[model samples]
Target: MNMKRLLTVVLAVVLSTAFVIAQEKTVDGPVITFESDSKDFGDIKQGDKVENVFKFENTGKAPLIISNVAATCGCTVPSWPKEPIAPGKKAEIKVSFNSAGKMGKQNSVVRIYSNASEPIEKVSLISNVLPK
Candidate 1:
């Protein structure tokens, strides 16, 4: 009887831990989506700056938290909301591409980290550069 009780206790503890781990989030209750998965600036000249906004909705039950936003290239700048996104609310990510010292087929990627199931999300920007 003692062994049975002990086994049951251990099983309970293990199951609880697994549940918590599975629910671990980088982005809180929010979902990150964009108007488009990618954006094309068409033809841009060197030294020009362009920007785009990514729109998303908080589709989860809890408030979504966006921890950080980063761009793969130094020439690309990205910004995201720092505060919690309440359920059924909306959020946006603003990205800027600086054409300084860059040319040809330029590609940039932005990653967003949140307390979400899939905490890391990616977006991309692409364009062809024209000479000044």
Candidate 2:
């Protein structure tokens, strides 16, 4: 009888652990999934600035908070929504690529810090610039 009780307890513990692990597998925060991971401007002219808006969805169970957004260089500027994105809601990130003093194939990244389970998300932009 004692051996049977011990086996049952072990089985219960194993089941509990498995349940916890399965829950942890899902993302816990903003879940900032984007429509596209990268954008290509194709061709641009020097001395001109190009802007693109990235669309994203909050696919998590909780409110998604974008703590910060950073650019790869000073020539790239990014603007993200300041408000919390509720579950199933959408948001946008506006990026401006400055071409002054820059040419050739230009690639930049936007690092996003969020209060989500992943904590960090990266989006990239690429373009080719020629002299005007």
Candidate 3:
């Protein structure tokens, strides 16, 4: 009975370890590799509009499908590719910010929803709005 109990405990430990290792393994799917995830527009006058493009590539074993891109605030807009990005292919996201009523340090965050290993990714735009 003692030997049986010891064997069961050892088996449980091995199974738990295996489970953890499997969970830690990287998912086999599309990976988004961005050239630069953030952009800085420096000092800009209020009411100015700024646009930027974020370039990224599908770096995993599968194609990447971007479903949507959302901005934290309505003053900013984002656009992304509608079609699937094949593995090893590249794409771009265009983001525009209107600093009309916004002033001082402004940080615009955009969330990208995609069918990638990391399903959600973030990019940011920063600027200091100066009064006219």
Candidate 4:
């Protein structure tokens, strides 16, 4: 082949190989798989406290490390496992809602930060608070 054609082929091959390598590297992290992304409390009475558990599993090659869990408001609180979740293992995040002064329709969000492929996941909580 001509020198110019040979150099062009070589450059293309090098770029394709580099891209493949980068994609493989990015896919090596843990993946989070949640059973459900939203929970409905249906109807709750005012001043009542309720809790729900969000289940998830690590479905990737690496261990899942959850860094933090945050709630959208003070009335909602979330708790998660402090240790790393191994591949194919399951975990749970507990969310508690205190309907102290809340009334009417309520919606809350819980943000989870982790070392997984997505890095962050959001779960939603919904309820219709009835007057006491």
TM-score of 3: 0.81
Candidate 3 per-residue lDDT, tens place, 1-132, comes to: 999999999999999999999888575799999999999999999999999999999998898999999999999999999999998899999999999999999999999999998899999999999998
| Candidate 1 lDDT by residue in tens digits, 1-132 | 999999999999999999999998655455655567678989999899998888888777788898888889899999888889888888889999998888899889998888866699888888888899
- Select the stronger candidate by TM-score from 1 and 3: 3
Candidate 2 lDDT trough over 10 residues, lowest sum: 24-33
Model 3 collision count: 0
The true-structure Cα RMSD of candidate 3 reads 3.8
Per-residue C-alpha lDDT of model 4 across residues 52-86, encoded as one tens digit per residue: 89999999989999999999999999999999999
Clashing pairs in 2: none
TM-score against native, each model: 0.74, 0.79, 0.81, 0.79
Clashing pairs in 4: none
- Cα error, candidate 4, residue 119 (Å): 1.2
Positional deviation of 54 in candidate 4, in angstroms? 0.6
Question: How much lDDT does each candidate structure score?
Answer: 0.85, 0.90, 0.95, 0.93
Query: Which candidate achieves the best TM-score against the true structure?
Result: 3
Predicted candidate 2 versus true structure: per-residue lDDT over 32-89, tens digit per residue: 8899878999889998888889999999989998989999899999999899999999
Which ranges of candidate 3 are over 4 A from the true structure? 1-25
Best-performing candidate as measured by lDDT: 3
Which stretches of candidate 2 lie above 4 Å from their native place?
A: 1-24
